[model samples]
Target: MLEPLGVDATCELVYREMLTHPGEGVAALAQRLGLSREDVGIALDQLSSLALVRQSYEPSGRQRPVSPEVAMRILLERQSAELEAHQHRLALSRAAATQLIAEASEAMADPQQVGVELLVGIDRIREWLSQLATEIQGEVLTFAPDGAQTQDNMDASRPLNLGLLQRGVRLRTIYLESIRSDAPTLDHVRSLIRSGAEVRTAPLLPTRMIIADRRLAMLPVDDHDSGRGAVVFSESPTVQALHALFESVWERARVVGGAPPSSKDADLAPQDAAALKLLAEGHTVESIAKRLGVSPRTARRITTSLQDRLGARGRFEAGVKAVRRGWLPMRD
Candidate 1:
């Protein structure tokens, strides 16, 4: 307490108190702060050394006016200093971003309409997207039928999303109607919207793919094994054709807007509903389990009489016949 008031805590306390009440008395200030008169005096002295404070004696029962000029000038001076600091930081940020964009563009080697390359792992796909994200300045066209981001994936994608947005790229993503049934996924969608993303939804979907600026795109060669050996990054004719196919499919698909579901939807054990729906869509018990966010045994038990109800030869026949019977349209 007696030592040269610590530069850290004391300085903070003095500044806080001065801003709070420049009219407080030494005794009253000490009482309110739970500090001794001597400590307050020391803090004031320390503050005065920085030209951040001024003290003067007045009549015993009188006070010194807190001149508007002094207060406003000090506040403006501090603000100006901070503004200058931020200006420098902004300049550096812009320079570094420009440099990164140049490097990312160069890494692309060649940028032509519809090119594709096979990416073996999730990491490779992420890297391809990250670089493309930085270099793309136009728009991101996304069609995620399966709603593929996990917590770990989102963490990995944070920097990528930020880089794309910072470069003034716009995003328009379409999700599956089923994604609305997952709370965590809904929360993720909210986060994306807050970050300036445009998201939409569709009913039935396949896997996921993205067309970045109509130049390069990501497409899956196989759909069953999502974590399979590889995915394709295409700037090829077939790739563009696939993108156009996706657009056509999307156009025919139902676009789910507001009022599709509520917060209660995630809690509504969709297992039964989804089981029936998938069964009607021609999915086997095992496939239905994964798609409905349940286990295989649960799906099989739930769909035990599905074929009997549909009067079909087997599960596959049951699914095909059920879809033809308009059962796939009942999502609730």
Candidate 2:
């Protein structure tokens, strides 16, 4: 019955037994439930991890079940928060799907057009990207959103990126501001910087993109699924517009590991401030953690700290106070 809340049958049974027969040892409960001692022990461990049980303060080292009134409430709240995050993610997926459908429809309507080409599937996307990389002559501008890049992605792009740098081709990439705290990703960025690539970070970015030599641009077909495919644009107006967007973001983004951010960045640490903005924007803590590339615990800590600093009772209030104090620019 409690499975929906992630309480397994054994754990729930053990919990119930402990509640009705307070202070009973594992062996006794194991005998009563006709389960192996190991099974009962494992259930206790799971319960402990869930905070449904704790070590007894008495001389005995047996586990103590927390009152359901308190423990269950916390579990329910956590489940509710996760549900909300799922809904928010679904909404984002729907919007991305709509955009993809429109772009695909347009491309289909003009089969002979040279403006847009839809490359459908990972293999096709990689082949096209490789072709673009080979043809690129002047510079490559990119937005690497969706948190810290995976090691596999970094490894795959290394040869291509190194080749560009070797040819003295300018390569500038913007990543999410949260990646600064990720050790491996940060090290990778530093290496790229040393190899003559320009790298910066912003608190938020609209989507993942790559523009080659101001002649061609690539955008993800689905923001959440990189392997799905991408849409390439070569039309002068479309490429030019994408270029303008990159330039605008580049002007505002902070140089990775360079000078301290400008005063306009406000009082909070850049990452924490970014987290606060996300919270205010109605993003769930789980989503915030993913965007920031930090653990949920760290995200929660940042949120709590921001709330304290702003003297706000909750995340929403903290965002309002931050804008009021000029910590964050008021959004339109």
The candidate that wins on lDDT is: 2
- List model 2 lDDT by residue over 222-321, tens digit each: 7778777787888679899999999999998999978887676546767877788787767778888877767789888888888898887765455556
Show pairs that collide, candidate 1.
114-235, 114-236, 115-234, 115-235, 115-236, 116-233, 116-234, 116-235, 117-233
- TM-score per prediction, in order, is 0.49, 0.66
lDDT tens digits by residue: candidate 1, 58-140: 45532232344664445445434544465466568867976874564344434452343556566676777767766787988
TM-score of 1: 0.49
Q: Which segments of model 1 are wrong by more than 4 Å?
A: 1-115, 145-148, 221-235, 252-257, 261-282, 291-325, 328-332
C-alpha RMSD of each candidate structure in angstroms: 24.4, 16.9
Shift in Å, residue 261, candidate 2: 1.5
Residue 74 of model 1: what lDDT?
Answer: 54
lDDT of 2: 0.83
